[model samples]
Target: MSSQAAAIAPSELLEAARVSKAWPFEEARKIVSRLEKEGGVSRTVLFETGYGPSGLPHIGTFGEVARTTMVRRAFELLMPGVETRLICFSDDMDGMRKIPDNVPDRAFLEPYLHMPLTRVPDPFTNEYPSFGDHNNAMLRRFLDTFGFEYEFASATEYYKSGRFDPILRRVAERYDDIMAIMLPTLGPERRATYSPFLPISPKTGRVLYVPMKKVNAADATITFDDEDGEETTLPVTGGHVKLQWKPDFGARWAALGVDFEMFGKDHGPNMGVYDRICAALGGRPPEHFVYELFLDEKGEKISKSKGNGLTIDEWLAYAPSESLALYMFLRPRQAKKLYFDVIPRAVDEYYQHLAAYPRQDVKERLGNPVWHIHGGNPPAIVLPVSFALLLNLVSASHAHDKAVLWGFILRHVPGVTPQTHPELDRLAGYAIRYFEDFVKPAKVFRAPDEVEAEALQALSVKLGTLPAGADGETIQNALLDVARGIERYQDHAKTSPEGGPGVSVAFFQMIYQVLLGQERGPRFGSFAALYGIDNTRELIARALAGGDLSEV
Candidate 1:
C-alpha cells in the first residue's frame, strides 16, 4: 500500500471492498487489484466505454458511461493516486447497414445506405455534417451536461488519421488466424465468404464485405473484387479498410491498451472471441464486465433500433441528472425497468441520499452513491420536503414558479433559497412539468361519501384549532389522529352496514383526489405540515364545499 492507502483506515478499505461486491465497484476493485499485481507498468490505466452511432444517443448510452464513471471513481478511492483515463469511443466508421426508422426524413437517407454513418447526410438538419456527427453532438451535449470527464474518440477520425495503422497491419498479418476463430461462430453460407478486412469500394465508395482474394501482409495491402467483376487493391493502412465487428472490438482493445471495458449482456457471448483475437495479436484483453440490458415498461428489451426505451432528453426533462446517476449506480448485473414512472422515486431517493450524506461517518459516506454521484463532495443543503411533496404542493397551490414552491420550502428549511439549492429548484420545475403531464391527465375526482365528508369536516375543524406556527411534526400527528378517528368511526359504523362512509383506502384516495386531483400522493401528514395549517384547512374546506377544487 502507498502512503495515501496507508493513511486510510483498514476498516474503511474493507468497507470499500465490501461495497465493490455489489457492482461496478466490484469490477473496479478486481481490475485495480489485478493491475497492482502486474508490476513494471508505468502508464495510466485506460478505461473505455463505447457507443455505436447507428441512432441518436439514448438512456442506455448514458447508463453505460455513467456506470463506468462510477466504477472509475470507486477505483480511484481504492487505489489512491493511480493515474486513469476514460475514453468515450464512437464507432462511426461502421457502414450504414440500414437507415434507422426513428430518424427524421428517412426517405432522404435511403440514397446513402451502405455508406459509413459519417458519410451519410444528416436528414434532420444541415447543422451537422452527417448523421454520425449529429449523433456524436447529442452524445457530447448530455455528457457535458452530466460533467463526465472523458476523451472522445471517433472511429472515422482515428482510422483516417493512421492511428489504427498498426492494428490494421496486425489484422492483415493474422487474417487466416482470425478467420479460424470467427468461422466457427457463423453459418455455412456466411462462413464461405466472411473476411476480417472489409475494403471500401473505390468505385461506389460503399464498404464491401466480399471475401478478400489476396492479402499482402508484407505490403499492408488487401485485394478484393469491387461491385464489378474487376479486382481492386487498396492499402489497408489508411481508412481504405475497416475490420468487422468482432475484430474491430479486439483490435481497438489492443491498440488503445484499454485496461477496462464494459458492454451489455447481449455481447456477453462475444467476450471470449474478442479476448482470443486480442491475445493472438500479442495484446491482453482488458478487464471485462457485462451488465444486463434495460427494459421498457412492457418488459421488452430497450433497443435503439426498436426505439422502445426512454431517451436521455426525456429523462432530463423530468428529473435531475443526479437522480439518473443514482439510477445507474444500482447493481448493473440486474435488469432495471427504465420508464417515466420511475422518475419521481429516483428524484426523492437522490434527495434522501443528500439528506443523509452529512450525517454518515467517513467510511459509510465514502461508500454512499451520493458520494460518487457528486464526485466525493455531496451538497450540504437538505430540503425538508421530498420531490413527491413538492409535486403535490405544485398541484395543490398551482405553483407555476420556483418562488412559490420556495415559499413553502423556506418555512421549513430556513436560510436556504432557490439560489443556494439550485438542484431542488430545478427539481421543482420538473415536478410541475411531470404533474402537468402524467398526474393531471389521469385524475378523476369523486365526491366523498357522507360519513367520509363528516370525518373530513371534523378534521378541518381540528386543523383550524392548531396554531399558525405549528411545525410539520405537530401537523402530521394531528392529521394522523384525524385518520385514526375516522377509522374507528368506520369500524363502528360497519355494524350498521352502509349506515356511514367507511374509512378504508378509499378515504385516503379521496383526499388525494380532492387536493392534488390524483388517486395517490405523498404522506398526508408530512404534506399537510409542509403545506402549512392554514393552506391545509383551505384545501380540506374546498374539497368539502363541493365547489371548484381547482383554486385550492
Candidate 2:
C-alpha cells in the first residue's frame, strides 16, 4: 500500500529561508559527518556558554540552549546512533558587581565581593541555600520544563573531578609566556604569580589563588597563599574552580574536549583570547556560533543592572512553550537583537509551519512516490495572521461547544481534518488561561472600569428588554453576533476607507460593546454557524439580562 494513500494533506514550505539553498544546512551536515567519522569525541557533547550572576533566566538564555538542541536534532537525523549532550554551565564563579532589586538586604551580600559566585548568598533565601543554588535551580527548572538534558554546574563539579589540574599545570608550564600575552591588556604591573584559574573561596572575599607549582594533575591538589602571606595546601573540593576568561578556554578544550560553543558578538575579543590559549595549551579551540541579545516589549535591551528584563515564568503565562521555542529557533544563533513583539506572530507562524514540515522520516529508507509526496517535500498551509485570527475566533466560542464549531470549520476548510490535536488542546488551554489571567469579566468596552449603569442602560435601549431570555447559549450567540459584525465592519472599513457608515456593521459592533464591551471580535456569522445561533444568542442575553449595557 502507498504511504500517500494513508497520508494526511500536505503542508507548505516553512519560509524562504528554510527552503533557501544558501542556508548552512550542508555545512552543518559536514560537521556532523566529520565528527562521526572521528569516533572518539562524542557527537553528543555540545558546550553551552554558562550564565552566572544573571538572576532569573531570560529567553536569550533559553535561545542558546534551544538552538544547540536544534543542531543536535539535525545531527541525530543525519547520523542515527548519535546521542546529544547539552552541557549547561553556570559561570557562578565570576565576580558579582550589583545586587538585584529583589534581594532583601544588599549589605549581607557585600561580604562575598571579588570572590567566585558560589560564595554569594542564596537569592531565593536560606531555605534554598546559596545564591548559586537558587539561580542555578531556577535555570534548571526552566530548561527541564523546556525538555533540555545533561545539565552540569560549573560551581561544584570541575575541581572534585580533577578537571582543572591539567589546565593548571599547563598554565604553570607556560606561566611566563601566558603572563606575557596577558600583560598588554592586564597591565605590566599585574602580579605574575597568578595562574589562569581562580576558584572561589567560600570563607574569604578574594578568590583562592592556587599556586601553579603545587598543582598536581594526578593528585588533584594545589597550594595557595593565605592572607598572612604563608602558603597553605588544600584539596580541590568544588566545581566553582576558575576559568581564565579567554585563555582557559583552551584549557576547557583540553580538559572537557568540548566540540561546540555559542556566544555573543560582545565576547568576540574573549573568543580570540581563548583561541590563543588553546594553541598554547596544544588544544583546538571549540567550534562556535555567536548569537545576539533579546529585548523587552518596549524595545529596550534587557539588562540585569538596569533592572529591566522578563523571566521565563512571566512569558510562559502568555506564550506557549513550543511557540517560545520556535521564536528562538527562527533566528541565526549569531549577534542580533531579538525583539519581543516578534513573539505573538512567531507563535502563530511556527504552529502553522510545523504542520508544513515533514512529520515522518522516510526519504532515507524508502524510494517511492508515496515518500515523495508525503515525506520528502514540505507542506503548504495557511498564513500565521490568518491562523491567529481564526484561533481567536474559535476561542471566542465557549470551550464546551468546540465540537459543533469544528464541524463548521471542516465545512469551509475541506482538506483540514479536525483531529483531536494536542496543539488544539494547548490552544484551548491558552484561551482559558489568557482569559483568567488578563481578561476582566466586567470590563465595559476596552476600558477596565467602564460604568455598569451605562452598559445596562445601553442594553435596555437597544434590545428593548432588561435582559434576554436566558444567560445560556442563546445570549452568548447574540453577543458573538455583535462582536463578529463589529470586526467585519472595521476590517471592511479599513480595507475600503472611503466606504460610508456601515449600519449593519455599526449595529453588530455596538451590540458587542453593549454586552461584551469590546469594539471588535470573533465572527458572528461563522460563530453562529459553528456554535449554533441559539447558543450564541443565549450568552449575550445572559450577559445583558435586565442589565444596562450603558452601565456595564
Candidate 3:
C-alpha cells in the first residue's frame, strides 16, 4: 500500500463516516440505525438490485449495482463486523411482453411474446441456450467487468429449483391479502384479469395472464382458464406457477430476507403494494430506496423497451469504469442526461477527485466520489495529465493512433512508456476514441479574424520568452498577459457581458478555435505543458502561418 493510503486510519474513517454528510454514508447509516432500533443485529444484511433482463443491461443498470456497492462499503465501515451480501437478481422469467427496440435484430422474438424469457431461443448466440440466459449472461459480464462482489440469482432458476418454493407457497396462502393490496393500483380491465399467481401453461409454454378461476391456498394450487377456455389447475410451487411482477417483487424480498433493496423512481409509486405483500406473506419488508431515472437526448426518461441512451459497452468504449462510477455516484437522486456529451466531464471530474483524495481529511474524503467509487480506498495515484488536456493533445496533433499520442506524451513526460504509464496509455486510447466519435465529426476550424491573428502572433512571441521547460501555470499566466495587452480584448474586458476575465477567456477561446477547433478547452498552458512548451510554440506558429494545424 502507498504511504498515503496507509496513513488513513481505519478508526478515523469510522468516526468520519459517522458524521459524514455523504449520501452513501447517510444511506448506510439508515441501515445501521434501523438494525439497532429494531432491537439488535441478528441475521446477515442482504442488499439487492433487480434487473428485468427483458432488454440488454444498460449503464443505468450498472448504476444501481455500483451505487449499492458504495452504500455497502459505507455500511461495513459503520458496523465493522456485520455480514453483508449484494445479490444482483435477474428477473429472467419475466414474459417477453415487448421486444426492446434497441437490442438489435430481434425480429425472431415476435412469435415468442408472452413466453418466459428463459423459454425463448437465444437470438444472438447459441452458447446461452435461451434468450433469458443470454441476457442474464450479459448482465453478469458487465457486472464482472467492474469486479463487483455480487451473487447472481435468476428468477427462473429460483422458481424452478424450489429455492423460492417456500415463499411461493406463502404467497399462495396470502393470495387474497396480496391481491387486496395490488388490485387498487390497477385499471379496471387489468384489475379484472390480475392474479398474484400466473400459472405457466404446459400446452403453450407461456405464462398466462388470465384471471384465476379458483385459488386453493390449502393445496397451493391456482386454477385458471387457458386461452382455449379449458380450466387448468397448477401448483404455485415447483415452477408450474409464477407471481405477477409486483407480487414477485415482494415475494422475492421475503424469500431472500433482503435487508435493503433499491428500485427506479418509476416504482416509487408501488412501494406500498410491495411492502404489504411481503407483510402478508409473514415476512418483514426490507428497506427500499428509490433513485432517479436516466434521461436520453430529448430529456425523456430512458426506457428498457424503448432502448434509449448509452449502453454499458458504449460508455466503457470512451471512458474508464472509474469515470462511469463517478458519474453514477454524483447526485443519484436527481435526473441527469445519460448521453455521449456527459463522458468528458465525468472523466475529468473523476481524475480531480482521485487527485484530491490523498490530501483530503477523512470527512472530506468520505464526501469525494472517488472515495465512494473505490470503496473508501481510492488510488493514491492518477494519470500524469487530465483527460481534458489529453483530448486537446489528440485534437491538436490530429493523431490517428494511440502510438502517435504516446510519442507526444513520452516527449513531454520523459521515461513514461506503455508499461510504466499504463493509466496514461489507457487514457490516451479513450481520448482517441472520444475524439473520433464526438470531436472529429463536429470540428470546424475557423480562421482567426484580423485582431485575433495579431493576438496569436503576439501570444507566440510571449510564449517564446519563457524557458523551454516552464511550468504550466507560468506558461498560462504569460499567455493571459499577452491577451491582456490586445486592444480588442482590453475593450471587451470592461464592456463584456461575462465580465473582466472575459478578456482572457475570449483570447483562449480564439486560440482553441483557430488551433483545436473546439469552443472551449483545457487551459492552453496545461495543454502546452503536457504537449511541451516548445511544441505549443510550434502549434501557434502553424496557426499564425495558416498551415495545417492538425498535422505534425
The lDDT per prediction is 0.82, 0.53, 0.85
Q: Write the residue-wise lDDT of candidate 1 on 406-500 in tens digits.
A: 89888856677887767678788898899877776766766777876887887888888888777767776666556656654444444333355
Clashes of each: 0, 56, 0
What is the lDDT ranking, best to worst?
3, 1, 2
- Candidate 2 wrong stretches, greater than 4 Å: 1-27, 33-49, 82-84, 184-195, 199-205, 208-241, 304-307, 333-343, 358-423, 436-552
> How would you order the candidates by TM-score, starting with the best?
3, 1, 2
Off by over 4 Å in 1: 1-22, 410-416, 419-422, 486-507, 550-552
Among all candidates shown, the one with the greatest lDDT: 3
How far residue 391's Cα lies from its native spot in candidate 2, in Å, is 7.7
Residue-wise lDDT of candidate 2 within 73-113, one digit each (tens)? 44444455666566887766666756666666778877766
Model 2: which ten-residue window has the lowest total lDDT?
Answer: 364-373
Q: What are the clashing pairs of model 1?
A: none
TM-score of 2: 0.65
| CA displacement after TM-score superposition, residue 45 of candidate 3 (Å) | 0.8
Which ranges in model 3 have alpha carbons more than 4 Å from their true place?
A: 1-3, 414-419, 491-504, 548-552
Model 2's lDDT to the true fold? Answer: 0.53
Q: What does candidate 1 score in Cα RMSD to the true structure?
A: 4.6
Candidate 1 — worst ten consecutive residues by lDDT sum?
1-10
